[model samples]
Target: MVSIFLRSLVYNVLFYVLLVLWMLMAIPTFLLPRRVFMRVAKAWARSSIWLMSAICNIKVEYRGVEKIPNGPLIVASKHQSMWETFALLQFFDAPLFIYKRELGWIPFFGWYLMKSRMIGVDRDGGMRSLMEMARRAPKEIRGGRQLIIFPEGTRTPVDATPNYMTGVGQIYASAGVPCIPVALNSGLFWPRRTFMRYPGTLVVEFLDPLPPGLARKDFIVRIKASIEDATKRLVDAARAEQAQLFGRVPAKT
Candidate 1:
């Protein structure tokens, strides 16, 4: 317990320090081209992943990376932990995240998001917000940027009842691109609102893409099925690995 506490504490401190430094370094990105800005942004994510492994003893393993198709596509993922927010950036060339509008208010961070041109949605604005997101998404998709959205909208504990939202379907139908479903077991290790990060492998798998032109209902069904099924397997596998690593199974948080 003490070891875990120490590791988590060190990770949190070092992680935030790196974040601030990266934000400072990213100030000049606003003047650069979009692709250059994305490269800078991905460097931050890569460094954070390195810190997670070096400080917290949590390693990440990605599967089915080859399944990611070229060109503009929708990458809809299961939201279980904050790790995916940064870690997933390395996978795409120029990825645009469908994130909350309030995130655009944070000082340097928000400035970076604006410069990066990430699509922001006002969650409380009801249907209008989703419509706005859908409206903005196609522009980016047409510009050859991959749209990364969380179908669940927010993070949930591993094995929690999934709350898949309609916004993803809206984007898929509007963007007219392939939708790649991503599943991960990140929550079993770096859970929400928790300082303790367990030492084990975190798995992220990109499932086959659902080709464009499916009806909204069918798109939603396939997206949910692919993510939930693979996510459940990852969660179960992580728990089993945790049992072997720590000598006890970790309860879903």
Candidate 2:
């Protein structure tokens, strides 16, 4: 336990230091094309993944990447830890994220987010904000960008009940593009609201894409079922591995 604690401390410190270095190095891309900045962002994601494996003994496996289609689409992923927020960027040509508007107020990070033209919405705006996102999303989709959205809207614990929002369905219905459901067990290794990083396999599987033109109600139901079921399998598998590693699975907070 003490060894794990020390490793987690070192990983966290290096993670932020690496982020600051990447942000500073990426500054020149602010004036360049969006794709230029995107390339840098993807590099950061790869570097972070490598760092996790090197220092924390967390191996990452991405399955069904060949299933990702070209052109505009929606990538609806399970929300667990902060890992996927940036790690998933490497797979898409032009990735777009809808984030809290307040994050866009940060110094360098916010400036880069604005430069990349990510969608920012006010959390307090309620239905109006959803409507605004619905209105703007299709335009970006039409421009051939892949929108990555978390159906749950926020991270949940590995064993928590699933609470998927209808916002992703709205975007799917509005964008008129196929939606890819991604399932992963990231929370097992990178648990939220804590500094301890566990050692295990982190799997992100991109399941089959749901075709466009389904009713919003049906779309929501299908997406929720697909992500939750796959996520359960992933979490269970990781828990077994953790048991083997430590003689018992870690307790959920």
Candidate 3:
């Protein structure tokens, strides 16, 4: 706990200070060539990830990145860690992130998000609200952007039970875009409500996108199962890898 607190303190100072400077940089992005803004911000995300990895002693391993396309596809990811958010920003092309609208109220960030026109959902939203998402999503995709959606809705704890939300299914059906299910073992190290990042590798694996033919209901069910199965595999593989490091085999996922 002491380590967690101290690390959080140090990280907050470093990150927020940088965030302020980044906001100033955003002014030019709003006016001049947006590519310049993206370039600087992308570099910042990479540097941020590097620093966090060092301070938290956590590493990330990715597979099947080749399967990811360069268009406006919907991403259904398991929500287990905040690291995934910042880590994702490192992907440069600037994906259209689907998150709660409330995040848009966070000082300069909210302003930045508003300027960027990032999609932020309101939970108390009506049908018109989702219709808006459906509409904006396609336009963004057609304009060459990826949408990152956490179908589980929220983060789950490491020792807590996990469940799936139907939003992912709705988005795929409504948006009529290819959906990619990505699984990561981040919860093992990046537990919710804690800064005590563990020393280990978070494995992110992307399965192939859902093909047409299946109805929306069946598509949803299959996607939910696919993500869970991939997550289970990562958990088992992480345990096995750790066990091997200690000269033993893990029992189960």
Q: Pick the candidate with the highest lDDT.
A: 2
State the weakest 10-residue window (summed lDDT) of model 3: 244-253
Q: Which stretches of candidate 1 lie over 4 Å from their true place?
A: none
Q: Write the per-residue lDDT of candidate 2 for residues 1-253, one digit (tens) a residue.
A: 7878888899999999999999999999988999999999999999988998999999999999999999999999998899999999999999999999999999999999999999999999988998998888888987999999998989998888888888887788888999999999999889899999999999999999999999999999998899889989988999999999999999873
Q: Whose TM-score is greatest here?
A: 2
lDDT of 1 by residue, 16-44 (tens): 99999988887787888878878988999
- Output the better candidate (2/3) by TM-score: 2
Task: State the lDDT of candidate 3 residue by residue for 1-253, as single tens digits.
Answer: 4675577567657766776787777777776555566676676677776766777665778888887766667777877888677666655375777767898988877866776668887877977777777677767765777677777677875434667766666666666667778888887666677555554577888888876446778987887888888888887777666565546632222
Give the Cα error of residue 1 in candidate 1, in Å. 1.8
The lDDT per prediction is 0.88, 0.92, 0.71
lDDT of 2 at 94: 98
Error of 3 at 163 (Å): 3.2
Question: Using Cα atoms with residue i matched to residue i, what is each candidate's TM-score against the true structure?
Answer: 0.97, 0.98, 0.83
Which 10 consecutive positions of candidate 2 have the poorest summed lDDT? 166-175
